[model samples]
Target chain A: MADQKEEVKLLGIWASPFSRRIEMALKLKGIPYDYVEEILEHKSPLLLALNPIHKKVPVLVHNGKTVVESQVILEYIDETWKHNPILPQDPYERSKARFFAKLVDEQIIGVGFGAMAKADEKGREVLAEQTRELLMYLEKELVGKDFFGGKSVGFLDLVAGSMIPFCLERGWEGLGLEVVTEEKFPEYMRWVKNLEKVEFVKDCIPPREKHVEHMNYMVERIRSS
Target chain B: MADQKEEVKLLGIWASPFSRRIEMALKLKGIPYDYVEEILEHKSPLLLALNPIHKKVPVLVHNGKTVVESQVILEYIDETWKHNPILPQDPYERSKARFFAKLVDEQIIGVGFGAMAKADEKGREVLAEQTRELLMYLEKELVGKDFFGGKSVGFLDLVAGSMIPFCLERGWEGLGLEVVTEEKFPEYMRWVKNLEKVEFVKDCIPPREKHVEHMNYMVERIRSS
Candidate 1:
């Protein structure tokens, strides 16, 4: 347990998978933190001050020290809290976990956003094709494992699970395409199914209807722009 | 020391700062390894087999286990060797180190590439301006610290030192514009000068003339295209 006097707070937008990644990590470790949801359109001064470099959400303040970047924050959480270890203990295994986490961030989340943001069908198709091609890497990674973390949710799972099965689930709908399906990504889908069963995993995920509504709202703006 | 029986090999291109980052980490840890210079245009079959995901260089093969990605490889080296520590032992300080390292990669390395790849003057100007704005963050970061790691060349130094001072030093000349300078980035330049005196860092950096020739060749191809 953390010192009772330690102050833990998270500044994040409710709909962001990035924010949810931190929430999941904090929840998984049972670290108590005060949540401050930022308005994306008009970010709070505190958020900007805390993360002036990016000025984006998902900033973790532990005893007044701020850590930005979702992956960096995840590592911070793992290192700060010892129980319910998110990352592997072995160095080699930790490297593998970090590699996949990076792959998911770049290929899945980054490209997945590109796939969603394209206002044109041709543009969306090209990116969706690229996203699918990238999905194969993740699928191959999951060939024999129940989760990216195996057995239970680990660092990669928190990174991948938060984005793919959560954000991309609604995002694919915005593109009028099913980016991830059992037929194409059986192992990935199986991993998603396994994540869905985890109670805390389910808890951290935003409500589907509200999420879909918010995603659609953003997609509409992108389409109009 | 790593087991004497273990085979350590690094597949890397001589001109690559990414590869050099790995090399510097290994040298700092005093780990002995055979280096295989990879032809980037026609990557070795062994390289492909080892890192099929990216099929890129700086692939570390330690006793048959392959670790790709420079940052991941650095962590692996630090953890596996447990000597001449690169990353800080404290989690918070480590997080700060990681944040700056990431800024260097994205803003300096990635954007610097984009700036260099722009064939047209306007395109280069726009990107150069963006890159400069980003460098201010690094300038602020180096306010009170001698190195990003503070004092000795640590993890962030290995990352930033490998790329900015080494790769970008000659790269600025290719564009006939200096992206980083003593006036604009006083502390960063001081850090660069400090790194220049570090014998191991100097050892990892490719000879200037060769790096310039290779960079110019690539730039010429980019311009013609």
Candidate 2:
């Protein structure tokens, strides 16, 4: 209301699942905006200025105000756009969606991400067991629903995707770990296929080839370092 | 609407900051509800059924539906009961509040919690340095405002209070750690006093003697284990 012309700009780098989360939100909401692809190693002045606290992308600069953290940015987008809603209407239901999204980031799959990156052979085996246990826990939740959101991709889907898109693309496959196979997790497999068909998701997600390459490099870097 | 008698319930453990966060929200919103005191080691059947995934405390059950995660529950309470808003009105302003809350949970105070819990002498020294650095950063944000929310106790204040309340009660002082000291963090001290004066917070927070006893026991258990 204060600014005559509103501008929505995203500061992020390609291959970052966090940044991609917000990009998916914008695309899903059908909002037009400028995107500043920042070099993570060399943090941009704008990125530093906007999100001095975190100084990480994907910071959503809306009408000169900054919203950091992909999850926070997603909420801001949903609130501002008010169309094709990401979270449910009921407070109770909204909490469930937020929980799944929160789960993905905090403990559900995050532990697996780090353990896989650094664990030795025996450690990796233990991690694989734990990850599968967690995946099954999530799969049990999707027993009857078409999506985590039910009938459409919702907030939880985005949150889960943000945590493991890179891993889903190739890292898991390369590591010989299975999470969403139709054989093991029929509902989860179906949900993945359903997400792949969504136009917004297709537009926002990086290509499999580039994502795999970048992810592999990152994994190798982390492992070696 | 569907259920003429909509029952609100909270499943939580006493002395848990997460649980207390929800209690504060309920008290602030002035909503009457049933409080289910759960044994952390041995969770209740209702707790397991309601929050099958996490099974953690501060699960708000409304009209048979469930909401887990303290932050998510806070949002739900604010939305469901419109009075005494936890978050600000404007979307940009809401984002800022959420950022501070997120920061308190994720990074700023999380590091401090871990450091105080397990760090050795050298590590504690490094942690103290980082903690002071972060406190100074937050202090800069509070150059003009009375609270993180500015004037009234708000979401970020609740979040920060959730973090250091254990320390706020002389628990950390018993451990020879000074976090919210008047000398070290002058503005933070004022904010702590302001929060303590709030009726809702006073009603919900555990008394100093009990909290300190529980905390010291926890600290010893952690050290032994």
Candidate 3:
């Protein structure tokens, strides 16, 4: 990374947890980056050239090398900027962190968001049951831990924590489908509060009112369509 | 890894690409591991305990430390073993490998498999087109490469190559849907042949006749139910 003239740029969209993951990682690492807000409907030529495969936002270009995929980007950032140490040093612990983060990403984006987007009433019930089970699993994983990284905000905190605000906005408030409550998942709730207090993440995330407004619009569009 | 006494064990099921991935990686690294085949219908308690979240196979237990998820396991193996060096040394190159491997994993398992599993005649046509497009995208990525890893059979090759034989046996020969033929994807077809030639992979994969029989059974079961 030192050999080349260093220039870090992150192309991302607001209200996208995936994009926000990269944004938060950059902030956590104390890495200064140029944030390019791309319109999802009309992607920039630079994004198309950099990430021809996905053509999506949250493309990190460091020293002119492009890295797509949020989790992959997070890994790249952690590897490049070794100051914060979001991922664990031990191979076993790192693997576990990756596993849980993958679970949360796939569950929220693939199953929960997907079912919420296109499901009918019966489908919503099934989605609700599945979401509850997923949250419970995460709840168990977070027991006796202040963060997924344990006493510090780490990789899972950056990845999973980025999605929590959206869940709060869309699932809890907008759609009234509560998955994480203090009663059920006290640990996960605490993790969310811990993430919110982190100076880097606080700056990276949008305010609650803005998130609710955006998520409400998304919910309406997805439901109507 | 050398300093400590190593006890590597892998829990996997035969006729599964994900399982085969770990098998191939262990072999490529020349790591001796006890392979325990678990019946999917009745998952072993050890399997459940090791990977409580997914409860799936291809779990690698190294010195009593458990690692689940095939890609994460591959990374852990590379990190721990460090002899074969499956993942690239450069941060950018490593990120790219993770990105493409993830794309192939998600696309094949998520889109192609899902559509192929549940689609009708008309639906099959659309799914076939989608599959072809996905393959074309991959083919484009493999323009001048001998393998996805370029010089040697690396991470993407191991993860992706494991899934191709099943595609041939299940999707093409068994079901008459050929998304990857020599005419269309010579590089990919060549990759399939090349992966078959690797000593570890050759020893690990099920025989052609056996694969055909198993895939036929899967096709029947999936189609029926």
Candidate 4:
């Protein structure tokens, strides 16, 4: 039920989990939008102008109004679109979803990079333990729930799901660690398998080999410097 | 318009800006809530149980459901109490407000801590410059608007306003830096002035002398360590 004047455009990089979350949200809501892939190394002038503060993507330009920060954009998407809701209708549930999404962003994805950046295996192991500890919380959160959003994939699923390929798979692979083993995070692994069953979610993830290669290159760069 | 079954309780500390934001949001919405003052140094068992994830204050227990994180709690408050909306009506404006609130948290309050913790003036000056650069963005956002929320104190105001005493005044005073001077950031200064005039906002802020003393103690601890 988008208006004729409702033009939606997303400036994103395909490999970025942040940008992918936006794509998944837009697709999940059945919102039609143009995708402009940004070369983050040499960002476009439009990208700079739209998100002058962060100078990053995915920048959702809705009717020329720019929305940056992926989680904030997710909320905007849910509010703007009535169909296929992303966040739970209940405020408490929505807060929990938001809280987990943030935990994934800050604790999992944020710390995953640190684990990958470790110059030595011992250092990597330490960070990996920290990641596993954080993942245990999510595992506990997943009990009797198929997704963080429950029943069907929603806000937190998109957020944590976007990181599955890049962060969990490639991130652990590139770092030569197994922080998310099925033994340790059985429920979390089940949650991941459930997410994989979603076609739209699968489409949002980058190719594993290509993502692993990129993550390895980045990890090497981080370790070296 | 609160229900009879609705019971709102807040676990917070007087000196914590994070905790104060929740208090302000509750007061702003005219939603009556029990204020359980938490001793952070020796956090109570209930506080630990309520927010086991962060084990932190500013946890909102509403009808036995807990919502942590000050920004998330602010959103929860706005949604639960529809009257005197803390966030804007339009999706785009709400997104902008959330973005700035986040900016204030991560950049201003977060980095402001770094600026204060610097053992040397040169280090503090460097971080103070970074803080100033970030504040300038808020300053620019404040132009032509009475508050970041526009015409009234809203989400961003509560987020930024909570930090006024702890981050800007006591924070700067403790560190011996003047990053948010009236001359340097005229619009932001005006916004602060406007917030001070609001009675509820003033009540949320801690006593200046006590707060400054506490902040200086924190600064010294950080520096020495």
DockQ leader: 4
DockQ of 2: 0.82
- Runs in model 1 lying further than 4 Å from the true structure: A119-123, B120-123
User: What is the lDDT, from 0 to 100, of the residue A117 in candidate 1?
Assistant: 85
For candidate 1, the per-residue lDDT at A207 reads 90
Show model 2 residue runs off by greater than 4 Å: A1-4, A118-122, A143-145, A165-169, B1-5, B118-122, B166-169
Q: Residues B1-106, candidate 1: write the lDDT tens digits.
A: 8778889999999989899999888888788899999997899899999998899989999988999999999999998999789999999999988988888876
Task: Give the alpha carbon lDDT tens digit for every residue of A6-80 in model 3.
Answer: 798999998788888888888777777889999867888988998877788789888878888999999998888
How good is model 2 by TM-score? 0.91
Candidate 4, which segments miss by more than 4 Å at Cα?
none
The candidate, 3 or 4, that scores higher on TM-score is 4
> At residue B222, what lDDT does model 4 achieve?
74
lDDT tens readout by residue for model 2, A127-160: 6666767777678768888778788877888877
Pairs with steric clashes in candidate 1: none
Ranking by lDDT: 1, 4, 3, 2
TM-score of chain A of each: 0.94, 0.90, 0.90, 0.95
Report lDDT per candidate.
Answer: 0.86, 0.76, 0.78, 0.85
Question: 1 or 4, which is superior by lDDT?
Answer: 1
Better of 1 and 3 by TM-score: 1
For model 1 chain B, where is the 10-residue window of minimal lDDT?
B169-178
Show the lowest summed lDDT stretch of 10 residues, model 2 chain B.
B165-174
Instruction: Report clash pairs, candidate 4.
Output: none
Docking class of 1: high
